[model samples]
Target chain A: MSIAWYLAVSGIVFSLGAFGVMTRRNPLVVLLCLELMLNGANLALIAFSRMWGNGDGQILALVVMTVAACEVCIGLGMIVAIYRRRLPINVDELRELQG
Target chain B: MSTVLFFLAASGVISGAVGVVVLRNPFYSVLALVAHLVSLAVLFLLLRAEFVAAVQVVVYAGAVMVLYVFVVAYVGGESDSVGERLRGAGGTGSSGSSLRLGGAILAGALLVELLIALLGTGLEAIGGYGAPYSPGPQSFGTPAYIGKLLLTRFLLAFEMASFLLLIAAVGGVVLARRRGGLGEEDERDLLTPLDLMRPRETGTMAEGVGGRTP
Candidate 1:
């Protein structure tokens, strides 16, 4: 198929992830949706790499993976801390920082 | 052959994404995410990103997802506290749940925007359909080439990524550890300024935030 086809699929996946982020109240689910968004971008990178015929996109995609790991690490750490504190896990409940 | 396989992987990817969003329980949603990640790996492979594909399975599916599982299990196994709170306060179509509705509309708008941008410019500059998949250098997707590029061309970035991992490890440990500094008297984390200012007599926490008079 065309690289455009791949790009289209990537866009759809990304939108789904965004929808999840918007709707889900659970922080864990939000993080999962974030992963889905990143994967969507990764798909585009690999598709373009195939089209342009280079490894740069693949390399960048690897970097994205590393960044995603770091993100999940910190986010989960925060969630655990919140749980430990007896705070409500609902994102709606925890608005201490809201101005 | 490749096209057929691509469609199959595409179906898996789309379905898994839907599952992650629609599954009410996060445990099931996490499982759905796993399916999505694996399908993504297959797509990576079809794109000839051999190294990335393998790493996607191992790092994402094996390592990162496991970490998520551990945290979710730890938080969840104790009680379904998170789930309960989510459903009670933020169930679909609830008055305060307009964010979901807005998000749905915005997501659709974004998809439309992206499709228009894509379709207008087109991928014709390079090959779109039936573009000859040219295998560049033999070492393209091999770890050796990537490693070489990492050590040579992208040395600083590679080192920084390693350092980033170290920082994340330390941050995780520090943030998650219990500190008994705050006692029952200090319920500061529970009370936002808005909550305290709104008069304790009226409105729940969610309502207090939204109905602020400022």
Candidate 2:
């Protein structure tokens, strides 16, 4: 019962992330959407783990949190540096890197 | 009842996610993202993954979002410029259009794959592996177990992660200071003549120009 709710919520989050990545030009917004996607997946894992009555899911959630924190630190650093360099923070501006 | 609640939450999440994606304004996207995060956290609770849900709210909703909001506020001007620049992306000459097309195609394919995988996986019935396995009598969900896992088996990893975070914190402070830097240095004597002309320090220049000056 609860698993169904989790799956549904996760699905929504994933879709939102996919949509954000697709449409939003701002890299920061894209990053936020990506975080949403990851969080959704974490919720799914936890839900399934709970349904199965195991600690594995909880552990996985812990790992996810650690990874999320690391990602935020690294991601923010890059964002700030890019801003300092006066590089475009938009996806459209990132095309300069392409051949 | 549970199924109904799950369906409702799922719909809420999906719509909010759509808003996150389709919304042109970054602020709206953030709002949608928050909705999605909160819904997912609630769903975690429903699944009996109580600890996981709590951590999700605390770490993701609390910490991560705060960081994101800070960055967004800092980049307010850049984001407005993005709105102006987005106009250039409509024509065929622009790579933005191509990338957007490619991204759409890829996202669609991935979504289809997810749906297929979810539908195909036979995880409908809860605790299908005979009876729902319960933990040992003494092994109820407790902070002790998690703490023990972190401090004992994963102690090295735990400490290493903390060390990494320390590095990141120091790095952030350094970068922030550099961004708004002001430090005094005597221009004339910061580097003396001898210091600047060390042969080894200047590499081939020592043997080249200095040696040739008769």
Per-prediction DockQ, in order?
0.46, 0.42
Model 1 over residues B50-85: C-alpha lDDT tens digits?
Answer: 889999999999999999899889888323344555
TM-score of chain B of 1: 0.72
Please write out the lDDT profile of model 2 over residues B1-214, one tens digit for every residue.
Answer: 7667676766766776777776767766677777776776666655655566677678777887778778778877357445645566655436656776777777777666665565457776432321254455334234665676677777776787778778877776655444533455665555678876675534455566677543
Q: Compared with the true structure, what per-residue lDDT tens digits does model 2 show for residues A1-99?
A: 535545545655665567566766678777777776777677667666766666666776777777767777777777787788777676666776532
TM-score, structure 1 vs. true: 0.81
Clashing pairs in 1: none
Error of 2 at B160 (Å): 4.4
Comparing only chain B with the true structure, the TM-scores of all models are 0.72, 0.65
lDDT of each: 0.83, 0.66
- Worst 10-residue lDDT window for candidate 2 chain B reads B125-134
Clash count list over all predictions: 0, 2
